[model samples]
Every structure is written in structure tokens, then in C-alpha cells.
Target: MEEWVIGPRLYNCYKCGNMICRHDDIVSKTFQEDRRLITGLHTVADVYCCDCGERLGWRYIKAYEEMYKYKEGKIVLEKFKLANENNW
Candidate 1:
């Protein structure tokens, strides 16, 4: 018989292999334009990996719409800049 084990999925920095976050922590995966995300226009600042300084994505500074207010203090990580922990 074979046994399978499931572990917590994680996201790591593509360049430095430093642990960045967990897959479950993701809030949304929407396209970004200028300083806005697809859900609503927002003011954002670039987020970086503390260990490598690689540009990971951006943190929302402000959300213009009332419905998106919850996203104001959240962050969005670029999928391409992260590697699945299992891959490494």
C-alpha cells in the first residue's frame, strides 16, 4: 500500500528561495493596471522580498470604492515571481 501525505502549500521567492507566504493567504488574483487592480481602482506600492529585495508585487494603499475597502491594507503577490514550495 502507498501512503500520501498532504502538507501546507507555500509560496517562495523565485530568485532567493525564501519563504514568502502561503497559498491559503491569497486574497485575490486579479490583473493590475497602473496603480489599480481589476476589482477596483486603487493606490498601491510595490512589495518586495525582505531577504532578496525582489519585486514580488504590490500592497494596496487605498481603494476608491466602498465595496473594496477591505483590500486597502492587503497585498497582491505576482504569480510569476513566486515558486511553489514543492517545486524547490
Candidate 2:
């Protein structure tokens, strides 16, 4: 008999094919506020790709409102800049 195993799903940088993060690492999708969006204010830092230095997205450095405090220290990566490792 043969044994089989499965690996965790991975997402890679689309440009340089660098391993970015795992699918299970994603937290939420409704926490985005564009850097240029003026309706609300948030203090965030740009998140760059480690290998290629591509501007992948931003990290929530500070959230002004108490309700949004949970977003602090979280990062959001652009969907277009990610590729599933299995697709490679």
C-alpha cells in the first residue's frame, strides 16, 4: 500500500514567482480602504514584495476608530499580484 499526503495551499508573487503567503493566512476581504480614498482616513504602510520589491499592497499601521482597531497590524495583498502555487 502507498501513503499519500497533502500540502498547504500557497500564494506566490505574480511578478517574480516568489512565495508570498498561504491561502489559510488570509484574514478578511472587507477591510480595504484605498490609499487615495478620501471618504475615511487610515494610517497604513505600503507592503512590498520581498524578492522583487513590487508594491503588493499595504499594512494597517493605525486605525483611528475603535471599531477598526482590529485591523491594526494586518496586511492586505492585491488579488492581481498573487498567483496560486498549484497553477504554476
Residue-level lDDT tens digits of model 1 in 15-46:
99999987777766565544435677788899
TM-score of each: 0.74, 0.82
lDDT at 64, model 2: 85
Worst 10 residues of 2 by lDDT: 31-40
Q: Superpose all Cα atoms of candidate 2 onto the true structure and report the RMSD in Å to 1 decimal.
A: 2.6
Please report the candidate that would top TM-score against the real structure. Answer: 2
Shift in Å, residue 5, candidate 2: 4.5
lDDT of 2 by residue, 1-88 (tens): 9996678889999999999998788986455656674545678899998999999999888878777787789898988888888764
| Candidate 2: stretches off by over 4 Å | 1-5, 29-33, 37-39
Q: In candidate 1, what residue range of length 10 has the lowest lDDT sum?
A: 28-37
lDDT per model, in order?
Answer: 0.83, 0.83
Model 1 ranges with Cα > 4 A deviation? 1-5, 29-41
